[model samples]
Target: MTDEMLMMAVKNGDLEKASELFDRYHKPLYNFFVKITFDRDLGHDLTQNVFLRMIKYRASFRQDKQFRPWIYQMARNIYADHFRRNKMLFSDYAEVEDLKNKIAAVDEVMVEDERQKLLYISLFKLQPEQREILILTRFQQMKYEEVAQVLDCSVANVKVKVHRAIKQLREKFLELEKI
Candidate 1:
């Protein structure tokens, strides 16, 4: 169903309509959660939580708002809760971590070189804030304004971050070659 139709159904408090909406949104939100949290199990749980929040508050679903941003806002809140409960401890990131590490593992067989594996590893070392911009814009193909909404920043800020993140990624790979 179209978003407006979905909203109308939701407004009517129809459980089946809520089910359809959750099914429609599950995968993209799952991918978004994984890119941020770096844990498949946690990502799955968080995606479910997002849908639950939507259903729990279906009466408040806005007719004018795009469902995407509303769902993304749900995701952002889930992420914040995780970090808050963790006592803000991303305390030690000793090496290349989660998303980049997993992507590099897949490329290990395809690329056929230690050098490129090292380069992929270097990409993760960029600040998490920067990496997130690339994932949302480059990987997810989100528009600048949508990305800005997800990240809670301006469209110009999202564009600038994507540019700078790419530059930094390149610089990091080059520096790795020197090591």
Candidate 2:
């Protein structure tokens, strides 16, 4: 079933639908959180929190709304709240111990290379907002419209931000490559 259909079933009191959604989304959600936090354990926790909130707030879900953006909105909020509470510096460019390790796992067949590692490092160097725009648009493959909904922003704004983010990432990647 489509995510929207599954979510609507969840909203209509078919609790198993929530589990189905969980099965489909949990890994992607964990990866999203891991990319942001650079901590797998925390990613797992935040991912769980996302689904719990979904169930707790199921009544607020409109059957007509797209489920992907709705779930992403919740994920974004959870990440923001955790960042705010922890006073974490999202722009830190230091080799994320966790990220460095995961790079090899990012693609089993594509042997980890310096350029790919540099790209991931450069991505982490970006401002949190820039990094997020890139992750959502590039890695997550979310459309500008869907990203706008998740971010509560306009599509034009998201497009502009995404463009700027790619530019920044390119610059960062080039600068890092020189080192």
Candidate 3:
């Protein structure tokens, strides 16, 4: 069944369809979570939490709203919570060091292709929100509407963010001089 049908079933307390939807979306969502968090165990735990949240709130879900956004919102929450906990655990210097490693890993993954490396190198300098907009828009191929939904923002806001991110990315690329 389609997500809509399955969601309706879930809302109506149909255990079977809810189980199917849970199983279907679990892996891809987990992978997305893992890539963003860069922590496998956290991703696994967050994935479980996301599905559990869905199950817990199944009856209250709006039928017109898309499940994808709902799940992505849960992921965003999980990510934010993790970041918060990490911030409290580490001293400023340690957190900076950890971020440096994360940034290096991000660069390695995205810059492997020499041609694309310039693009990512430039983008890396932007604010986190701008960088996130670029990743969700340019790399993920998410439509502005869907992205806005995932981000819990307006479509116009998403567009502005993407446009600015692209402009800044270009500037960064030029500053780096392709080397």
Best by TM-score: 2
lDDT of 2 by residue, 23-125 (tens): 9999889878877655577888999999999999999999778999999999988888887686764434355775555554443422377666676677766
lDDT of 1 by residue, 143-168 (tens): 89888777778989888899999999
lDDT of 3: 0.72
Q: What clash pairs does model 1 have?
A: none
Ranking by TM-score: 2, 1, 3
lDDT of each: 0.72, 0.82, 0.72
Better of 2 and 3 by lDDT: 2
Model 1 residue runs over 4 Å out of place are 89-120, 177-179
lDDT of 3 by residue, 67-177 (tens): 777777776776677667777421122466776775676566535676565665455456656766776777667788988999888999999988898888778888888
lDDT preference between candidates 1 and 3, better one: 1
Worst 10 residues of 3 by lDDT: 88-97
Return the clash pairs for model 3, or none: none
Give TM-scores for every candidate, taking all chains together and pairing residue i with residue i.
0.77, 0.85, 0.72
CA lDDT for candidate 2: 0.82
Candidate 3's C-alpha runs over 4 A off are: 22-24, 38-41, 88-96, 103-112, 115-125, 175-178
